[model samples]
Target chain A: MNADFLLKIDALSVSFGGVKALENYKLSLPPSRILGIIGPNGAGKTTLFNVLTGFIRPDSGHIHFNGQEITRWEPYQIARLGISRSFQNICLFGKLSVLDNVIVSCQIHERTSFLSALSKTRAYKKNEKALREKAWKLLCVFGLEKHADRRAMTLAYGDQRRLEIARALATAPKLLIIDEPAAGMNPNETQDLLDLILKLKEKFNLTIVLIEHNMNLVMQLCEYIQVLNYGRLAAEGLPLEIQQNQEVIDAYLGDTNNAGSN
Target chain B: MNKNKHALYLMISMGLFFCAVYLLDAYGNHYYQRVSNLMMIYVILTVSLNLSNGIVGISSLGQIGFMSIGAYVSAILTLPPGLKEHWLTGLPHWMSTIQSGLFPAMILAGILAAAIAFLVGIVILRLQGVFAAVTTLGFLIIVKVVAENWMTVTRGGRGISSLPTYTNLWWTSAVAVITVYVVLRIIRSPYGRSMLAVREHDLAAQSIGINAPRIRLLAFVISAFFTAVAGALWANLIGVVSPGSFYLWLTLLIIIMMVVGGMGSVTGSVFSAIGFTILLELLRGFENKIAVYGISSIIFAIVFMLVIIFHPDGVMGDREFSWDWFKRITPLF
Candidate 1:
């Protein structure tokens, strides 16, 4: 109910075939803050991301963003309203060039009409130039400029992950939801990704919600952490408090020795 | 400097193409000219179909439905008032008396097809992959049934004949050039990039703010417009309009051209259409010489299978004919 929050989800619920995926999930995210949602497998973390991005409609809920209710909005509409997301599975446009993948996201903000594009008018040319430049700069940010013309599917797994984030950022979103960006990365890549995410947050002034099983990443990055167990919020607090919470430890974190491995 | 070079090359190639067309029109035999005209019509059909099925990855099989709509509309409008009264007695008074030149009739045909596509797209664009393809095939069947049973307007299976011979080599080639230019322009634009995104991954596309359904619908409508224009060209060239002509055979043939050219490639469609048209004609000649019926179709089927098995992505594999490619090949020559 706080008007100052950037994203507010209240009493959100979703079910599939009589099995509740998310029940009464509530979260209030303020502007430019990083919130990490951690849980064991089937903890409804991705379900929450899906619901927030409008890929999955909640059974009963209200999601307010920037003082506007956006419950059950279409994914593209939500995206156009400055909510962008990257998938848990690297869902880059496989056949398109790496630059084109970013350019496609950049196009959502273009002012050129279809007619202008067809006619190749001055506005369209200028807009296209701007989009290419922006896409190239984004690629450079992720160290992907050298592979701009390569097909997205041809990139290395780590690079594909970076490109997915770059493509999501190209949308100029106020809120970015990334699902397990560090899932398949080695320690070095994970560290690089951690730094990149932090830099992107400051550079883009973005409010981020990430679902991560990487405990190190969660501990190091997130300002606020929420633990979900069995489609319910088990704990919510600062990272240090989350680590110490006995219930969270029992439900998801487990013993401190095995926590990082988990 | 690169842009200017590309433009100069384009102008030279176009000049060469037009000169060839002019020479053929002036001196080529009637049969040769007609065959060339047929190639252009097929080029239009394949390119338009490619916009939806190849680039947008909708895999629609209803392109011929739009073509039939165009053919019937253009045929009716361009038919002389006297012929309309004599043949289409069930027509309304306004329709029977109305007259339109070939250009206006073709334009109207394209518009009508696009309108129909807009409505049909709303319902079927929600379907994906094979489901969408099957639904569009059903749309084609529905159009055919209506064209067959609605004897009042279409004159049923007997068809309307003796239309104007307006689709000369010049007209067909000009329209084909325009179709290629417009389609390629679309494929290169931001909108086209969105279409490609939608084709590559529907959910991923939507997450990045590309409305997959809307993009599919736009591609469908534009494709329908061009397909209808091609149908108009065909009706005029053949001097007949028939529901039978816009059926499964033509649909399969056009799809084959698109597949052989490489889906998601405009230049591929153009080359494949032209290549297939000539190849089919030569096959027909071979069939006639051997007095063997259905042999051409068998050969074509084998060729199609080979292309699918070996190349898999078709001859062009989604790569357009670029100046770089031209430069590379020219050195070998």
Candidate 2:
């Protein structure tokens, strides 16, 4: 248990049968920091997130968050422990309204269960009002308050991406992992996304881990960076040092054919 | 009126209408009354299946297994003395008690069926698509086979007969109304929303801290339980039970009614089930050829194909028919 460290992965290794997905990986960070992970398409970035969040338990590793050993925790368990994640593909509930989607994500704070919702108990009504207000404010922060009543699946690509962030933030997570917030965005939208990320990170006091291929966003936004070539760390340091690191340059930026590999 | 007010009025109207039908049956010819009893049972079957396929999106065709469990449990328990002797059975002591009347037997049958479904859900629910369909289909076959070979209790291929025709319109219609309300209530709860979330996206639901597997299991079991009680009512209404009672054809037909009506739509399921059942009940007098067209067995297949092809969001597409919306939006006539 290392409560002082907002997140820590100790000696993590994941293997899918014989193929190694991630190996002997380790990192530790406190709150109010952004860690960017960049690697090729198969560099095990998503696998790392899965391991930390218990979507896939590593064959060997210990994941500690806010002072609890959480190696084999389920995805829901990690979430309840205040760690939240967004998938590489914006995994919002497509059939629900955007506002409803955010409210569902905030179930961590909802006191009522399915039984109580049927009866419309006082706790259910009171808590639901507060949760809806919270979800509305989150959508407002992301400039999505106007679209709250629309189906989440009907959102245009940019709003969908922004709504994913809003939904993730609704969890009130201590640590948030976003697979790729800037993917599929136009340059202008990407900049808007970056600005929104900075605002929300400060507003929520969150430690963020981002997996992104956009060099500009990574270089400008992350305080620390971890680079991977093929499931193993290629380099780890400041953004300037990473841009100049000979190994990172030759490995990640080397292949023009696999451009945007991460 | 608005959608909510419309729905509220419709619900109130439906209650009054069904009650009037029950009262009319009390004074009507025996044959018309019997047909109404059959329609009420179909209402339960279709409405309960809607909870799974419509709201939760499991897309099942194995509900006959649950119904079969209900049928055999209720029939065995409620077998009158002559029928019991003819079936070559020394009744289980518990069966002796339910032979007393209709409500107890149906209630017990529903509970028994739900318990089986709850247990089976724990085992086979992790499977989706064809694997789940196969598992449940196999379950149905096993139940039928047991009914055949266990002649001492089930009367084998000859089936159980002389079942007391106690499940008249009064009680059957009551079950119909209650089951539809129960399933409707289920889909509107947090549990219902979580099941819908899982259907929409399993990883997303879990990512949001909803327990996906558990929610699926709950919906699956509850649907099974209610469907089973409907089966018990059917067994009594028809006054005959056989190995042929719960064939795959029936399962396919149930699925068809659900699909044509619109999977995941309460109003759709109920309307389709009643229309399909009444149409078939009429067609049974027309001999063999037209029966296929009249029965949902054929209609469901076509509707299912089209639903999957064009209307994959289903008839309702996650939208509850909101009486509240009706109240807000409707123009006063």
Candidate 3:
């Protein structure tokens, strides 16, 4: 039991029917750190995220976050507890404007009652105005202010990805977990994303846990790395140490060959 | 500043609109007044349905179930105690002796319907997409069966007749305005935004700390409230209450009004409710003179098919009639 650690998980296991999605996963993360989780496809990276975010219950596990047990909380509860995530596939509210997406996210912690909103009271309007300004500030950081009124679905793919991160940040999360933020970007875009991730970490003093397939971005952005293969941990160390680990290399090579062949 | 101005404009327009409708009711013929009443009731129904079907993204056909609950409950409560004894012999003695006024009965009807909808929504809202719709459809069937077979309170399949006519153009339209006002308030509120997010993608909504099922339930319960009120109005208007009046046909009529009015647009729902009511009345006239029966159904079918083909998004695609449309005409005061 590390008193200073912000998130601690032990013996986490989950199975869907007969197949094991995650087995005996363990993690200890400190505050104000960037930890990267890398794995081949079907290696249970997303499954772990699902369990942590309360989308899926683990068959057996214990998860403690910010000195409280949160293993069985609902997704919305997890989010309100300052744990926010973005999806692997973009999940922006397609019909709402980009600004509205962030505004909705901002409501997680800063909520006005339904009655007050219905009344449109002075207090409610003031709170709403402050939140709207905060949302605009987030958009401005991501260079999305110009397109704040445009429908989220109409944004370019890279911008949509950026908007997702901005929306997540609007939750005022202590632990921000982003899944595959650089999945479809070009090299230049990936480089830009790496810079943005670092900048956000400094700006917000955030603890980030990201799963990425882009090796360059992962190597540049992560201080610590954990590798998984076939639902088992292959390596865990600093980024340089994981790069030199034989098991990690073999796992990546094997999966790359399979993916390339297909 | 703009928000206050928008609110003022809305208030003025709504006041004028109601005044015009009241005058028309006073001057119009019996046929015209009847059509207008039906239109207002449908407006209430479609707007409430829009909250669940369009805003919350739940395809529920169980609205007719809630409507039936409202109709029977209100009708039973408001019936004269003397008539209750003769019409519903199977009812308990205490129930037969209680005769409530129309206003309180309608309020209770709305509350009862909302309670049932809340309980049912908690269970069936967990089902995703079409499965949820199917479960709610089953709910509608069960309500119909209960209304038909439960002779104790409902008088079985024959239904209750000779009820007092408490509904008129003024009352119906007043309720309609209230419904619209409440719905607009909800749509502009934070809760409404959360409901819309749930409609877009439930998973994303949950991730953003919006409880998808809870939001859906809120919309469902509120929708049931207004839907029940509409049913109470309808029961009084026709001077009868029957299981047959609130069957799949009524559900289909409400859905058509929603689809043809642009599923997600409140303004579209209001206008489409008016448009279809007039169209159906015209077709009913044909059924009386011509040898053909079910002419109204045929016309409705044609209109639905045409709307689906040509204007699938309805007359308004998630757009509202806003005060901005009036800003240009201001006298620069």
Best-matching candidate per lDDT: 1
Against the true two-chain complex, what DockQ does each candidate achieve?
0.89, 0.62, 0.79
* Model 3 Cα lDDT, one tens digit per residue, A1-262: 5679899999999999988889899999999999999999999999999999999999998999998999999999999998999999999999899999999888887667877977789999898888899999999999999999999999999999999999989999999999999999999989899989889999988999999998888888899999988888888999988887878887783445456676
**If both were scored by lDDT, which would come out higher, candidate 2 or candidate 3?**
3
- iRMS value of model 2? 1.5
- lDDT, candidate 1, B171-287, per-residue tens: 899999999999999999988998999999999999988888999999999999999999998888898988899999999999999999999989999999999999999999999
Over the stretch B193-272, how does candidate 2's per-residue lDDT look in tens digits? 67778888888788778777777778888888888888888888887888888987777777777777776788778877
For model 3, state the Cα shift of residue B70 in Å: 0.4
The reply for model 3, stretches above 4 Å from the true place, is: A253-262, B1-9, B287-291, B325-333
RMSD of each: 1.8, 3.6, 2.6
lDDT of 2 by residue, A1-262 (tens): 7677988888889999999999888898888899999998989999999888888989897888888888997787778788888888888888788988888787665546666766768987787788788888888898898999999999998898888888878889989999998999889988988898899889999999999999999999999999976778889999999988889988786645557887
What lDDT tens digits, residue by residue, belong to model 1 across residues A1-262? 5689999999999998888999999989999999999999998999999998889999998999998899989999999999999999999999999999999998887656778877999877887898999999999998999999999999999999999999999999999999999998999999999999999999999999999999999999999999998899999999999999999988877786776795
DockQ ranking of the models: 1, 3, 2
Report the TM-score for the A-chain of model 2: 0.94
- Chain A TM-score for predicted structure 1: 0.96
Pairs clashing in candidate 1? none
Predicted complex 1: DockQ: 0.89
Residues B190-260 of candidate 3 have per-residue lDDT tens digits of 78889888988898889989989999999999999999999898888888999999989889999999988
Could you tell which candidate, 1 or 2, scores higher by TM-score? 1
Clashes of 1: 0
